[model samples]
Structures are given as structure tokens and as C-alpha cells.
Target: MALSTNCWKYLVLTFNALFAMSAVVMFGVSGFLLYRLFVYRHFIGVNVEYPAILLLMMAIITCSVAWIGWRTAKSMHHFHIVLTGVLIFLVVAVQFSCFVWAMVVWDSVDIDIKNSMTSFFDVANEVNNPNSPESIRWDRLHVQKGSVPFSCCGQGPLDAKFKPYTADCSTLYQRGCAKPLHQYTRQQLLMVAMAALISSVLQK
Candidate 1:
């Protein structure tokens, strides 16, 4: 059956809107990540990961979709509509999943940091109290640094006592309080891989 001109125009317009939105979202997210990696070098680190690569891939896919949509606008076709629809759905799903995973990891890190902080404070208060039992002090000496530092009690010039104050600080806090942040970043990298997988599946 021959497609009506009005029907074809509507299809092309819809495709254009969908692809354009996808392209903008992908580009914006990828660019933001890249900018963060560059500007906040310590936060994102120098090493590349699967998530970073996947974000880049998503940006490329979105651009491709935009291009195809533009072409379709010039010459609408049934096949183009089907292709665009499938691509839009797949890309959107992947993007949404990646975003959700990122948020989850981000929140996990926050909770971990908060818990670590609470533990550090409890140990610290025990250590600071003069009337506290010698046993409590002994126990506090064994506290290792946690993933995030509640206070710089065991860092810098004070770190000299970290070995003796092990109970007051977690190994994570002692070694470098940024370890959990690094883990959070690594999880973000995994999200990029997820996005890449989606892009690959969509390409198929």
C-alpha cells in the first residue's frame, strides 16, 4: 500500500524529534563527564574506563541518529521510520539504565562515607575522653582509618600516630580517605560499559 504524504510527514517529524532529543542528551552527558574528567582530574582520575568509553559511544550513536533523522526529513520512507523507532527505543533504554546505575553507585558511596564517618566519630570521642577506661583507649588505638575521614585526626602531621591510633581511624581513612570515591568512580565506568552494550545491541 502506498503511504500518504501527510502520514509520511508526520512520521519524519516524530523521528526527527526523537533522534534530536537523544542526540542532545547523549552529547550533554558525555560532554559533562569528559569535562569533569578534565577539570576535576583528581575526582575522575586520568585512567579511562568502560563507562567513559561507553559514554563516548553513546554520543556517537546519538549523532548518527540525528543525521539519519535529518536525511529522513528530506526524503521520508517507511524503512527509515522503522529503523528510527527501533534505534530511539533502544538508545533511550540504554541511557536510562546507565543513568540509574550511576545514581545507585553514587548513593552507595555517599552512604558508605556517612557510615564510615559515624564510626570514626564514635571511636574519636572514646579516644578524646580523659575519663574513658584504659581498655577503651586500647581498643581505640586499634581503629583503622575508614573509607572517608570524619576528621583529619589521623592525617598529615598527625598521621604519625595512625599506627598507634589504628582503632581510632580505619585503614581506609589512614591510607587515603578517597578510596571510596575511587570505587564510586569505577562503578561509574561500569555504567559506561552497560551503555556500550546497549549501543552495540541497537546497532545490531
Candidate 2:
């Protein structure tokens, strides 16, 4: 029975180490995405990067909590084991709450993107060249390796060429950047939540 318990403890530790590493990786990814969004924030309009920031914060918190879990998992001290369980429980609760909240607000994410894109299109139409910052940013997103804009069929019947500041709804990709970005963020949060759940189970 003692040997079996030791084996189970080590198994949990292995899982904890994996979770800790994943949290670290998530932290880096969220930070990078936040940076990218910040760079193009002027054209994207208000509150565009807020979700990314939230994710980054979550990642940071997970990393810290995961580290504690890992350390406790490796330690045989009775107090450490009890403390680890409590900490894992708290983290799991907090993470789940945040995840659900984020999902609830996620429905409006597309609307915000639409609003931002509308503003972007209005400004882009007014400019003839990529001379303006907003226009340049708009062009930058669609710019390919050969400096050509990749045209996509939008809602309009006619497809518009994505060139400099001339890209309108017709010229932009049917799947807007915002949709994919928001989806990816949502998925990331889900992944984090799953990881947290697994960690909680392992703690038990």
C-alpha cells in the first residue's frame, strides 16, 4: 500500500510538471499576441486588445500557481502536500470562473470587430495611398511577400482588390481577422481551463 501511494504521488508530480510547462508556454504566446494587437491598435480602435491582455494576465497567474504546484508535488512534506491541494483548488476555481465570464462576453467580440473594421474602412477609403498610418496598417495586414494585397470575396457580390487604402468590405477576406483572432483567443482560454481542470484532478 505504501509503494502504491508513492507511485501515485510521483504520477501526479509528472502531470504537474507538464501543466507548469504548458502555463509557461501559454504566457509567452499570450504576451506575443498582445504585442501584435497593440502594434495595430490605432487602426483597430478601442478595447481591441483588452481580451488579449486578460488572457496574458491569466497566463501569468497560472504560471505562478503552477510553479507552486510543481514544487509541492516534488516535496514529501505533509504541510506542502496540504498546501498544494488548497492552492490548486483555489486556482482551479478562479480559472473556471474567469473562463465562463470570458465565454459569455465573447459573443460581442465580433460586433466590436465589425465596428472597428467599419471605422477602418471609412478611413481607408478616404486615403489614396498607404501614406497615412491607418492606411499603412490596413495594407500591412494583407500585404504578401511580394508586396501584393491578397484579395478576398467579402459580403458584396463583387470582389474588390486589396490594394493600399482601397480595400473595402468587398476586398477584405470573407473571414475577418477579428473572427479568427477572437476564436483563437477563446480556444486558448478553453485549453487553459482544461489544463486547470486536469491539475485539479491530479491534486485530488
| Candidate of highest lDDT | 2
61-161 per-residue lDDT for model 1 (tens digits): 77777678677766767788678767767766666665555555454544544454455546657677645554343233333224232333443543655
Q: What is candidate 2's CA lDDT for residue 118?
A: 78
lDDT tens readout by residue for model 2, 85-197: 67767766665554554455454556665677778878787875557766666666545212334333234333456543433755344544555545544454445444434
lDDT of 2: 0.59
Model 2, runs deviating above 4 Å? 1-5, 28-40, 43-48, 118-130, 141-204
Location of the lowest summed lDDT over 10 successive residues in candidate 2 = 144-153
Full-model lDDT, candidate 1: 0.54
TM-scores, all candidates, are 0.44, 0.53
Off by over 4 Å in 1: 1-4, 7-11, 14-18, 38-49, 107-204
| Candidate 1, position 139, lDDT | 36
